[model samples]
Target: MSANQLNYSVSNAGAFSDFASVTEGMLKGKIFLKDGLQLTSMEVSLNHLPPKGEVPFYHKHQQNEELYIFLQGQGRIQVDGNEVDVHEGTSIRIAPDGVRALRNTSATQGLHFIVIQAKENSLTQWVETDGIILDQPVEWITRSSCLK
Candidate 1:
């Protein structure tokens, strides 16, 4: 294996002990860096947003695009001033230059989601370079829920 390659790895994303405070009432756990995975330049994280809270400000990535996969609760994501409702299983891919922000709109339900961010125009090589095989069936396995 190449020095940069990471063998198969797993993480229990629900354990919230180690979290970075994004804002008051909002926190995120960086899973990619924590796992030491060099598979992609992507940044992966699980974010928690309290009800009625929102991202502090609209922002845009100059070189990285972002994909948000909502896992629970209800929210609205505004991309370039266009708002769209989001719920469990909702996914949104935003261009690197698109201004974006998220808000937890549910009065009682907190929001939880995964965000994967990576540089624009950098993903195709995963297939061309055989970094990821496209034809194989995906494998699913469970990890212990309590990870310290």
Candidate 2:
């Protein structure tokens, strides 16, 4: 068999406690994945906003576009002065120069979401062209085998 050749990093954000446990900065309730995962191409953050909470400031990026993916609760996001409601399963892509801010509007539930930032107009290939299908056998591993 070929030598195992793979590199990866895994972390549980919950190990740091609930998102709202952070009390020091504008990035409260947020955890950055880039530093922890040593990612080279993009920045990713997991966020949770307490009820009626907000992002604290409106900002724009110089060259990176952002994608926001909402996972729980409800909220609103303002882009370039226009506000739109968002909820679980909502996904939005904002261009580099679009001014943006967000808030959790739910009166009782917290908002959970993820944001991914990457260079604008940098994707030259997608799954169809960028991924290679290996001609290898498909083997299913049983849970019992994992313990051994």
Top TM-score model: 2
User: How far is 147's C-alpha from truth in model 1 (Å)?
Assistant: 11
Candidate 2 lDDT over residue span 28-82, tens digit each: 8888888677788899888889999898888999999999999999999999999
lDDT of 1 by residue, 4-102 (tens): 314554554443323334432233433444344444567777677777878878889989899999988899999998999999999999999999989
Clashing pairs in 1: none
- Candidate 2: which stretches are off by over 4 Å? 1-5, 15-17, 23-25, 140-148
Candidate 1 lDDT (Cα, 0 to 1): 0.72
lDDT of each: 0.72, 0.85
Stretches off by above 4 angstroms in model 1 are 1-6, 13-40, 125-148
TM-score list, all predictions: 0.68, 0.86
